[model samples]
Target chain A: MTKTRRPNRAEVEPIRVATVMDVPGVIALDEEVTGLLKPAYWRDMFERYGARPGGSRVFLVAESDGRIDGFIIGEVRAWEFGSSPSGWVFAVQVRSRLRVQGLGSRLFEAVCESFRAAGVDRIRTMVAPDNTEIHSFFRSQGMMAGPFIELEMRLD
Target chain B: MRLQKATEIALYAVLELAIDPERQLTAVEIAERYGISTHHLAKVLRDLGRGGLVDSVRGVGGGYRFAGDAKRLTLMDVISLFEDVSADTDELPPQEAGQEIARGLRFVLTELDTQSVATLRSITISTMLKLIVRRPWATIALEPRRPTVRRGR
Candidate 1:
């Protein structure tokens, strides 16, 4: 019987801070997943999170074989609605075909390390109810319900 | 997450009508497509008509047409008409045993309810339509398929 060798994850895909050159890859990956092209939105995100020098905001991407497979964006928010400073992950995405291969988990851990370095003890994020994939991923990472409620009303 | 039969039917009817705002479909046609009861769908459609979400036509070949703005109409709006989406807490008479576990469970359930409501509120009919179109099977399921006729050998 022949045995298949398992590839080293770190050697196969490396997670690193995103640069200006990586903005296009991030945008393309996002569009591939969401089917929407919002170059301006992504450019603005890169400008605020990647280009800026603040350690509070972090934008990281996973690269494999010179292709961007995933990206995560988060920042440390303080005293928003009377809560203590915490890391808020606004967006995270991995290529659909490459999901469940631990890329998302690795990206999540990389961002969490950045958050810890920024001196935040807790992390927060909002996921849609129908987005079970993300919910399960967060749950696997030991995230549970937090002491907060989101309320909204429509205005014409 | 549970919805009343009326609410579910209303959602199907509304989405069907909204698929093409110009296309009018009778309650019977909508019910038939979904394999649901026409009588029940009629009641739901009547309520939707009162809600100003649909227009009922009176004469030959006339039916209900979507009147509400698909971009503005949300699943929560339609659901609120037939049922309350709020999470209601069960009052357990003061008991020492399992109190902590009960409190924790309640908190989790409340959080889930909050997330559900927010998700429903954020998703509009237009968004739902886009999602439906994006699904690989949706196109095949939604489009009318022509019947194949077998030729004599």
Candidate 2:
């Protein structure tokens, strides 16, 4: 009789380009993390990142057991806030139970690879100052403070 | 029902077409009017096209126009075109409810999901337009919210 070794969680899921099929899984993960159902927002994101014909955008998902457990979305833009061209990561979500298993890092690196291929040297993302977990994650990814600052006003 | 940003954009794009069924509005013009990303709006327009809610043309001066009967289109229809409207509760893992209160909270969440879908299905696009004139922001279309000309400094 032949015996096969069971794969670990990190080895179980393979990271791949996200498709329309992954949208529901992505939404479910986001809702579990953020407590909001933003399906419309995700649909728009999927179209821009998942369906784009060429460079400048990337959407990646880590799938296992026919379900998405982690995903990242990013795009390249120039001259925003008077800054030069850079890659901006708009969203990242990993299934809660699967954190620290290197799945999220793999997704991040996949998007970063796409950004680098698009000719952008810098990658940026906005995270609330108090979000220590995200801050630490970005820090681990070698992200630092950038030149631009976000400014907003309330008319009400 | 809380709408996704994409759904809201879809509604606006459809509304623009509804207000002028003959004019084929380019995604760029619509995005410019709202100060949103043209790239994103373009994708939304493409989805609307695929959903059979709008038709598109190619080459110079090409754009999109409403393809379906406006009065018959509901907000649910537009939203469903972009997203899966079902709650998809089966996707959620079974939660460990050790206490009665925890189970009650879970029930409330499920009820909220049901109510959200029900409300979205009830409102039609035409009925949503009727709500515009009643809102404070509606003054921009109904009347000149600002003076026609600024007074001499």
Candidate 3:
């Protein structure tokens, strides 16, 4: 006799975008995998980018067991954050234990699909030189490393 | 949905208090700071006092004290205080019976009534204040920078 397990229906629901309800849960998930950028900063980001016109900035959160396990925040900006030709992967992170099982890919593909629907033609992200693991993650997704490097300075 | 004029004014005024936070400033000063008017500023302050955001003192050396902190103050929280959400619901004009437009309108109005204030407050006083100091995008607006005043000999 041969038997196969049916795939979970809940997994077919697609990655869900962040609602006002998921802010704290998603923030906690982010803290587990990356340096904390402060709750206020995150609140500002989701509010501005999520509610932006044209549905350009999409924030998706993955949940399991009634808790956020990961999130992806991406924006469709033309030249800059809003300028037109591209969408930038502003941030995406998954819980440490859930890393290898496709949650990040689901979140990434969900964001890319949303941006493609928004008419965004290209995707970009600024990755640090030292983060070899994350660099490999992007490469595995068939993303090419461009020649341009991001540089910034704050004048006070 | 647009923020009620009073709510916008109060945000700017209270943020000014957060910046200064020493003593109360006059109605005219607050208005001028935001490029609003004294009459309008006073109206906003009265609303703030009603909402318990700022306390008023009478006479010389009396102005306004921030009854709250910037971190604790969400822009949404402040705007909601001045806005009458229930009263706004009362103002919906009844329309034709066939379409049920009122139901849809009520839904949108309710959403805006809740969402707009919370969104605005999400952008805190600190970011707005920083924008004032570093107006990098001022050039982007398509307005004439200098108006010519003809010199008469």
TM-score of chain A of each: 0.90, 0.85, 0.81
Highest DockQ scorer: 1
Worst window of 10 by summed lDDT in candidate 2 chain A: A139-148
Second chain TM-score for model 1: 0.81
lDDT of 2 at B41: 88
Better of 1 and 3 by lDDT: 1
lDDT by residue (B15-109, candidate 2, tens digit) is 88877677898998999888888888888998999998889988899899888765456667898887776654553345655556766666668
Sort by lDDT, top down from the best = 1, 2, 3
lDDT of 3 by residue, B1-153 (tens): 666887788888888887766768888878887789889888888888888888888888788877775544556567778775432555544565744677777776776554443335344454455555665357335544445569999
Model 2, span A126-156: residue lDDT tens: 8764454565456445554554556577999
Alpha-carbon lDDT, every model: 0.84, 0.76, 0.69
The candidate that wins on TM-score is 1
The collision pairs in model 3 are A77-A84, A78-A82, A78-A83, A78-A84, A78-A85, A79-A83, B24-B64, B75-B121, B76-B117, B76-B121
What lDDT score is found at residue A86 in candidate 2? 87
Model 3 ranges off by over 4 Å: A3-14, A35-37, A52-54, A80-84, A147-156, B1-153
Tens-digit lDDT string for candidate 1 (B30-66): 9999999999999999999999999999899999999
For model 2, report DockQ.
0.01
Better of 1 and 3 by TM-score: 1
